[model samples]
Target: MEVTPLINYINRIVTLTPEEEIILSEYVVYRQYLKDQYILQQGDVCKHANFIVKGCAKTFHADNNGQEHIIMFSVEDWWASDMGSFITQTPADYNVQCIENTELIQFNHETIEELYAKIPKLERCFRQITERALVSSLKRIVRNFSKTAKERYIIFKENYPEIEQRIPQYMLASYLGISKEFLSKIKSQLAKETKS
Candidate 1:
Protein backbone atom coordinates (compact mmCIF):
# COMPACT_ATOMS: atom_id res chain seq x y z
CA MET A 1 0.00 0.00 0.00
CA GLU A 2 1.11 3.54 -0.72
CA VAL A 3 2.20 5.52 2.33
CA THR A 4 3.01 8.80 0.62
CA PRO A 5 0.15 10.59 2.35
CA LEU A 6 1.33 9.57 5.81
CA ILE A 7 4.91 10.40 4.96
CA ASN A 8 3.92 13.80 3.63
CA TYR A 9 1.87 14.56 6.72
CA ILE A 10 4.78 13.67 8.97
CA ASN A 11 7.19 15.64 6.83
CA ARG A 12 5.04 18.71 7.20
CA ILE A 13 5.47 18.52 10.95
CA VAL A 14 9.10 17.37 11.03
CA THR A 15 11.52 17.01 8.17
CA LEU A 16 12.55 13.41 7.62
CA THR A 17 15.55 12.16 5.70
CA PRO A 18 14.95 9.59 2.95
CA GLU A 19 16.38 6.78 5.06
CA GLU A 20 14.27 7.82 8.00
CA GLU A 21 11.21 7.87 5.79
CA ILE A 22 11.96 4.34 4.65
CA ILE A 23 12.30 3.20 8.23
CA LEU A 24 9.06 4.92 9.19
CA SER A 25 7.22 3.25 6.33
CA GLU A 26 8.58 -0.13 7.29
CA TYR A 27 7.25 0.29 10.82
CA VAL A 28 3.72 1.14 9.80
CA VAL A 29 0.95 -1.19 8.65
CA TYR A 30 -1.86 -0.56 6.18
CA ARG A 31 -5.44 -1.64 6.72
CA GLN A 32 -8.89 -1.03 5.29
CA TYR A 33 -12.32 -1.11 6.86
CA LEU A 34 -15.84 -1.06 5.46
CA LYS A 35 -18.39 1.53 6.40
CA ASP A 36 -19.88 1.10 9.90
CA GLN A 37 -16.95 -1.04 10.96
CA TYR A 38 -15.41 -0.36 14.34
CA ILE A 39 -11.76 0.60 14.44
CA LEU A 40 -11.69 0.84 18.22
CA GLN A 41 -14.58 -0.46 20.26
CA GLN A 42 -15.42 0.61 23.77
CA GLY A 43 -13.85 -1.48 26.54
CA ASP A 44 -11.19 -2.77 24.15
CA VAL A 45 -7.60 -1.63 24.36
CA CYS A 46 -6.70 0.64 21.46
CA LYS A 47 -3.68 -1.11 20.05
CA HIS A 48 -2.84 1.02 17.07
CA ALA A 49 -2.62 4.65 16.20
CA ASN A 50 -4.52 5.01 12.92
CA PHE A 51 -3.84 7.63 10.31
CA ILE A 52 -6.50 7.95 7.67
CA VAL A 53 -5.45 7.67 4.06
CA LYS A 54 -9.03 8.00 2.82
CA GLY A 55 -12.43 7.88 4.47
CA CYS A 56 -14.31 9.25 7.46
CA ALA A 57 -14.67 8.02 11.03
CA LYS A 58 -16.25 9.22 14.23
CA THR A 59 -15.15 8.64 17.82
CA PHE A 60 -18.00 8.53 20.26
CA HIS A 61 -19.22 7.21 23.57
CA ALA A 62 -22.52 5.51 24.20
CA ASP A 63 -24.25 6.48 27.41
CA ASN A 64 -26.34 4.32 29.70
CA ASN A 65 -29.43 5.31 27.75
CA GLY A 66 -27.69 3.91 24.65
CA GLN A 67 -27.38 7.31 23.00
CA GLU A 68 -24.11 7.93 21.26
CA HIS A 69 -22.35 11.23 21.94
CA ILE A 70 -19.83 12.03 19.28
CA ILE A 71 -16.49 13.31 20.46
CA MET A 72 -14.95 13.99 17.11
CA PHE A 73 -14.98 13.17 13.39
CA SER A 74 -11.86 12.42 11.40
CA VAL A 75 -11.29 12.31 7.66
CA GLU A 76 -8.48 11.85 5.21
CA ASP A 77 -5.11 13.06 6.55
CA TRP A 78 -6.40 12.97 10.10
CA TRP A 79 -5.37 10.63 12.92
CA ALA A 80 -8.06 8.57 14.65
CA SER A 81 -7.44 6.75 17.91
CA ASP A 82 -8.47 6.78 21.50
CA MET A 83 -5.36 8.61 22.61
CA GLY A 84 -5.62 7.71 26.26
CA SER A 85 -6.19 4.08 25.53
CA PHE A 86 -3.43 3.91 22.97
CA ILE A 87 -0.91 5.59 25.18
CA THR A 88 -1.83 3.78 28.37
CA GLN A 89 -2.73 0.46 26.80
CA THR A 90 -6.04 0.47 28.61
CA PRO A 91 -9.61 -0.17 27.59
CA ALA A 92 -11.09 2.65 25.56
CA ASP A 93 -14.12 4.63 26.61
CA TYR A 94 -14.90 5.69 23.06
CA ASN A 95 -15.56 3.78 19.87
CA VAL A 96 -14.00 4.79 16.60
CA GLN A 97 -16.20 3.68 13.71
CA CYS A 98 -15.91 4.25 10.00
CA ILE A 99 -18.49 6.54 8.49
CA GLU A 100 -17.39 5.42 5.04
CA ASN A 101 -15.09 2.76 3.63
CA THR A 102 -11.71 3.71 5.07
CA GLU A 103 -8.06 3.08 4.41
CA LEU A 104 -5.51 3.68 7.17
CA ILE A 105 -1.84 3.55 8.02
CA GLN A 106 -1.43 2.22 11.52
CA PHE A 107 1.38 2.04 14.09
CA ASN A 108 1.20 -0.47 16.87
CA HIS A 109 2.64 0.49 20.25
CA GLU A 110 5.79 -1.59 19.88
CA THR A 111 6.44 -0.50 16.32
CA ILE A 112 5.96 3.14 17.25
CA GLU A 113 8.33 2.76 20.17
CA GLU A 114 10.95 1.23 17.92
CA LEU A 115 10.48 4.02 15.41
CA TYR A 116 10.95 6.59 18.16
CA ALA A 117 14.21 4.90 19.10
CA LYS A 118 15.42 4.62 15.52
CA ILE A 119 14.16 7.98 14.27
CA PRO A 120 14.13 10.24 17.28
CA LYS A 121 12.48 13.05 15.34
CA LEU A 122 9.34 10.93 15.12
CA GLU A 123 8.77 11.53 18.82
CA ARG A 124 8.67 15.28 18.19
CA CYS A 125 6.31 14.85 15.24
CA PHE A 126 3.87 12.74 17.22
CA ARG A 127 4.06 15.05 20.21
CA GLN A 128 3.07 17.98 18.04
CA ILE A 129 0.20 16.01 16.59
CA THR A 130 -1.00 15.04 20.05
CA GLU A 131 -0.77 18.62 21.30
CA ARG A 132 -2.76 19.92 18.37
CA ALA A 133 -5.46 17.31 18.92
CA LEU A 134 -5.64 18.25 22.57
CA VAL A 135 -5.97 21.93 21.75
CA SER A 136 -8.74 21.23 19.27
CA SER A 137 -10.58 19.15 21.86
CA LEU A 138 -10.31 21.90 24.43
CA LYS A 139 -11.57 24.45 21.94
CA ARG A 140 -14.57 22.30 21.14
CA ILE A 141 -15.35 21.96 24.84
CA VAL A 142 -15.21 25.72 25.33
CA ARG A 143 -17.39 26.26 22.30
CA ASN A 144 -19.96 23.81 23.59
CA PHE A 145 -20.29 25.74 26.81
CA SER A 146 -20.16 29.22 25.28
CA LYS A 147 -21.83 29.02 21.88
CA THR A 148 -25.51 28.66 21.04
CA ALA A 149 -26.66 25.64 19.08
CA LYS A 150 -27.16 27.74 15.96
CA GLU A 151 -23.75 29.30 16.38
CA ARG A 152 -22.16 25.88 16.84
CA TYR A 153 -23.96 24.61 13.73
CA ILE A 154 -22.69 27.55 11.72
CA ILE A 155 -19.15 26.95 12.93
CA PHE A 156 -19.39 23.25 12.20
CA LYS A 157 -20.65 23.97 8.70
CA GLU A 158 -17.90 26.46 8.04
CA ASN A 159 -15.17 24.20 9.38
CA TYR A 160 -16.37 20.88 7.94
CA PRO A 161 -18.62 21.64 5.00
CA GLU A 162 -17.53 18.45 3.26
CA ILE A 163 -18.35 16.31 6.27
CA GLU A 164 -21.85 17.77 6.58
CA GLN A 165 -22.79 16.26 3.24
CA ARG A 166 -21.38 12.84 4.11
CA ILE A 167 -22.87 12.24 7.53
CA PRO A 168 -26.50 11.80 8.55
CA GLN A 169 -28.33 14.78 10.08
CA TYR A 170 -28.84 12.91 13.35
CA MET A 171 -25.13 12.19 13.64
CA LEU A 172 -24.33 15.81 12.95
CA ALA A 173 -26.80 16.82 15.63
CA SER A 174 -25.16 14.41 18.03
CA TYR A 175 -21.79 16.00 17.32
CA LEU A 176 -23.21 19.46 17.93
CA GLY A 177 -24.90 18.31 21.18
CA ILE A 178 -28.37 19.12 19.89
CA SER A 179 -31.44 17.25 18.74
CA LYS A 180 -31.98 16.46 15.05
CA GLU A 181 -35.20 18.50 15.02
CA PHE A 182 -33.41 21.44 16.58
CA LEU A 183 -30.73 21.29 13.93
CA SER A 184 -33.42 21.37 11.23
CA LYS A 185 -35.01 24.38 12.92
CA ILE A 186 -31.66 26.11 13.02
CA LYS A 187 -31.09 25.40 9.35
CA SER A 188 -34.51 26.73 8.42
CA GLN A 189 -33.97 29.87 10.46
CA LEU A 190 -30.62 30.45 8.84
CA ALA A 191 -32.18 29.98 5.40
CA LYS A 192 -35.01 32.42 6.12
CA GLU A 193 -32.53 34.97 7.36
CA THR A 194 -30.40 34.50 4.28
CA LYS A 195 -33.41 35.11 2.01
CA SER A 196 -34.62 38.22 3.82
Candidate 2:
Protein backbone atom coordinates (compact mmCIF):
# COMPACT_ATOMS: atom_id res chain seq x y z
CA MET A 1 0.00 0.00 0.00
CA GLU A 2 1.15 3.53 -0.76
CA VAL A 3 1.99 5.75 2.21
CA THR A 4 1.99 9.05 0.37
CA PRO A 5 -0.01 11.00 2.93
CA LEU A 6 2.11 9.78 5.79
CA ILE A 7 5.18 10.80 3.82
CA ASN A 8 3.65 14.14 2.90
CA TYR A 9 2.59 14.84 6.48
CA ILE A 10 6.12 14.17 7.65
CA ASN A 11 7.62 16.08 4.76
CA ARG A 12 5.75 19.19 5.82
CA ILE A 13 8.19 19.50 8.70
CA VAL A 14 11.13 17.38 7.60
CA THR A 15 12.27 15.71 4.41
CA LEU A 16 13.36 12.12 4.82
CA THR A 17 16.03 10.38 2.79
CA PRO A 18 15.23 7.25 0.76
CA GLU A 19 17.00 5.10 3.33
CA GLU A 20 15.06 6.71 6.16
CA GLU A 21 11.79 6.05 4.32
CA ILE A 22 12.85 2.43 3.83
CA ILE A 23 13.44 2.11 7.57
CA LEU A 24 10.13 3.73 8.39
CA SER A 25 8.20 1.46 5.98
CA GLU A 26 9.90 -1.66 7.29
CA TYR A 27 9.11 -0.91 10.95
CA VAL A 28 5.64 0.46 10.50
CA VAL A 29 2.82 -2.10 10.70
CA TYR A 30 -0.58 -1.55 9.15
CA ARG A 31 -3.67 -2.56 11.08
CA GLN A 32 -7.43 -2.47 10.70
CA TYR A 33 -10.14 -2.35 13.34
CA LEU A 34 -13.89 -2.73 13.33
CA LYS A 35 -16.08 -0.25 15.16
CA ASP A 36 -16.01 -0.57 18.98
CA GLN A 37 -12.72 -2.48 18.96
CA TYR A 38 -10.10 -1.29 21.40
CA ILE A 39 -6.74 -0.13 20.18
CA LEU A 40 -5.66 0.48 23.76
CA GLN A 41 -7.26 -0.03 27.18
CA GLN A 42 -6.90 1.38 30.63
CA GLY A 43 -3.98 -0.12 32.60
CA ASP A 44 -2.25 -1.24 29.40
CA VAL A 45 0.97 0.45 28.43
CA CYS A 46 0.71 1.97 24.96
CA LYS A 47 3.23 0.10 22.83
CA HIS A 48 2.69 1.80 19.52
CA ALA A 49 2.05 5.29 18.26
CA ASN A 50 -0.91 5.09 15.89
CA PHE A 51 -1.49 7.26 12.85
CA ILE A 52 -4.95 7.14 11.34
CA VAL A 53 -5.14 6.32 7.64
CA LYS A 54 -8.93 6.48 7.54
CA GLY A 55 -11.97 6.50 9.83
CA CYS A 56 -12.06 7.55 13.48
CA ALA A 57 -11.04 6.47 16.98
CA LYS A 58 -11.73 8.01 20.38
CA THR A 59 -9.82 8.09 23.63
CA PHE A 60 -12.08 7.97 26.65
CA HIS A 61 -12.45 7.18 30.32
CA ALA A 62 -15.11 4.92 31.83
CA ASP A 63 -16.55 5.79 35.19
CA ASN A 64 -17.90 3.64 38.03
CA ASN A 65 -21.39 4.12 36.63
CA GLY A 66 -20.20 2.54 33.36
CA GLN A 67 -20.51 5.76 31.44
CA GLU A 68 -17.75 6.71 29.04
CA HIS A 69 -16.52 10.28 28.67
CA ILE A 70 -14.68 10.80 25.42
CA ILE A 71 -11.56 12.94 25.62
CA MET A 72 -10.68 13.17 21.94
CA PHE A 73 -11.36 11.74 18.47
CA SER A 74 -8.60 10.97 16.02
CA VAL A 75 -9.48 11.14 12.34
CA GLU A 76 -7.67 10.57 9.04
CA ASP A 77 -4.02 11.71 9.12
CA TRP A 78 -4.19 12.32 12.87
CA TRP A 79 -1.78 10.85 15.39
CA ALA A 80 -3.07 9.20 18.55
CA SER A 81 -1.54 7.94 21.76
CA ASP A 82 -1.98 8.34 25.46
CA MET A 83 0.94 10.75 25.37
CA GLY A 84 1.98 10.54 29.02
CA SER A 85 1.73 6.78 29.12
CA PHE A 86 3.41 6.36 25.74
CA ILE A 87 6.36 8.51 26.70
CA THR A 88 6.69 7.49 30.34
CA GLN A 89 6.03 3.76 29.85
CA THR A 90 3.31 3.90 32.46
CA PRO A 91 -0.15 2.41 32.56
CA ALA A 92 -2.80 4.31 30.62
CA ASP A 93 -5.95 5.60 32.31
CA TYR A 94 -7.97 5.87 29.11
CA ASN A 95 -9.02 3.65 26.23
CA VAL A 96 -8.66 4.25 22.54
CA GLN A 97 -11.59 2.69 20.72
CA CYS A 98 -12.51 2.75 17.07
CA ILE A 99 -15.58 4.76 16.08
CA GLU A 100 -15.69 3.15 12.64
CA ASN A 101 -13.89 0.48 10.63
CA THR A 102 -10.43 2.00 10.48
CA GLU A 103 -6.97 1.62 9.01
CA LEU A 104 -3.88 2.75 10.93
CA ILE A 105 -0.14 2.71 10.70
CA GLN A 106 1.55 1.90 14.01
CA PHE A 107 5.20 2.07 14.93
CA ASN A 108 6.85 0.95 18.16
CA HIS A 109 8.63 3.47 20.37
CA GLU A 110 12.04 1.94 19.77
CA THR A 111 11.58 1.86 16.02
CA ILE A 112 10.61 5.51 16.14
CA GLU A 113 13.66 6.36 18.19
CA GLU A 114 15.79 4.61 15.57
CA LEU A 115 14.14 6.71 12.92
CA TYR A 116 15.00 9.83 14.94
CA ALA A 117 18.66 8.91 14.75
CA LYS A 118 18.50 8.28 11.02
CA ILE A 119 16.38 11.30 10.21
CA PRO A 120 16.68 14.23 12.58
CA LYS A 121 14.00 15.99 10.56
CA LEU A 122 11.51 13.34 11.69
CA GLU A 123 12.11 14.40 15.30
CA ARG A 124 11.23 17.95 14.34
CA CYS A 125 8.01 16.81 12.68
CA PHE A 126 7.03 14.70 15.68
CA ARG A 127 7.96 17.53 18.05
CA GLN A 128 5.67 19.88 16.18
CA ILE A 129 2.92 17.29 16.30
CA THR A 130 3.33 17.01 20.06
CA GLU A 131 3.07 20.78 20.41
CA ARG A 132 -0.12 20.85 18.36
CA ALA A 133 -1.62 18.01 20.35
CA LEU A 134 -0.79 19.83 23.56
CA VAL A 135 -2.53 22.96 22.32
CA SER A 136 -5.60 20.96 21.33
CA SER A 137 -5.68 19.29 24.73
CA LEU A 138 -5.51 22.68 26.44
CA LYS A 139 -8.31 23.99 24.25
CA ARG A 140 -10.45 20.97 25.07
CA ILE A 141 -9.93 21.61 28.76
CA VAL A 142 -10.94 25.24 28.29
CA ARG A 143 -14.05 24.22 26.39
CA ASN A 144 -15.05 21.79 29.12
CA PHE A 145 -14.55 24.42 31.76
CA SER A 146 -16.18 27.37 30.03
CA LYS A 147 -18.61 26.23 27.32
CA THR A 148 -22.14 24.94 27.68
CA ALA A 149 -23.04 21.67 25.96
CA LYS A 150 -24.70 23.36 23.00
CA GLU A 151 -21.82 25.76 22.58
CA ARG A 152 -19.32 22.89 22.75
CA TYR A 153 -21.36 20.96 20.17
CA ILE A 154 -21.35 23.95 17.86
CA ILE A 155 -17.61 24.37 18.21
CA PHE A 156 -17.00 20.67 17.59
CA LYS A 157 -19.17 20.77 14.49
CA GLU A 158 -17.35 23.82 13.18
CA ASN A 159 -13.90 22.36 13.89
CA TYR A 160 -14.38 18.73 12.90
CA PRO A 161 -17.38 18.46 10.62
CA GLU A 162 -16.05 15.29 8.97
CA ILE A 163 -15.56 13.59 12.34
CA GLU A 164 -19.05 14.68 13.38
CA GLN A 165 -20.47 12.91 10.31
CA ARG A 166 -18.51 9.71 10.94
CA ILE A 167 -19.07 9.05 14.63
CA PRO A 168 -22.34 7.88 16.21
CA GLN A 169 -24.59 10.34 18.00
CA TYR A 170 -24.23 8.70 21.40
CA MET A 171 -20.46 8.85 21.22
CA LEU A 172 -20.56 12.44 20.04
CA ALA A 173 -22.83 13.22 22.97
CA SER A 174 -20.33 11.67 25.34
CA TYR A 175 -17.60 13.78 23.81
CA LEU A 176 -19.66 16.93 24.01
CA GLY A 177 -20.71 16.41 27.67
CA ILE A 178 -24.38 16.04 26.79
CA SER A 179 -26.86 13.20 27.10
CA LYS A 180 -27.81 11.49 23.88
CA GLU A 181 -31.35 12.81 24.17
CA PHE A 182 -30.07 16.35 24.58
CA LEU A 183 -27.81 15.96 21.57
CA SER A 184 -30.72 14.64 19.50
CA LYS A 185 -32.75 17.69 20.46
CA ILE A 186 -29.87 19.92 19.53
CA LYS A 187 -29.49 18.14 16.21
CA SER A 188 -33.19 18.55 15.48
CA GLN A 189 -33.06 22.20 16.40
CA LEU A 190 -30.01 22.80 14.22
CA ALA A 191 -31.66 21.00 11.31
CA LYS A 192 -34.85 23.03 11.56
CA GLU A 193 -32.92 26.27 11.71
CA THR A 194 -30.75 25.27 8.73
CA LYS A 195 -33.83 24.52 6.61
CA SER A 196 -35.03 28.10 6.92
Best of the candidates, lDDT: 1
Q: lDDT at 62 for candidate 2?
A: 91
TM-score, candidate number 2: 0.92
TM-score of each: 0.98, 0.92
The per-prediction tally of clashing pairs is 0, 0
lDDT of 1 by residue, 9-105 (tens): 9989999999998998889999999999999999999999999999999999999899999988999999999999999999999999999999999
Candidate 2, after superposition: displacement of residue 63 in Å? 1.6
Which ranges of candidate 1 are over 4 A from the true structure? none
Worst ten in a row by lDDT for model 1: 106-115
**Residue pairs whose backbone atoms clash in candidate 1:** none
Model 2 segments beyond 4 Å from truth? none
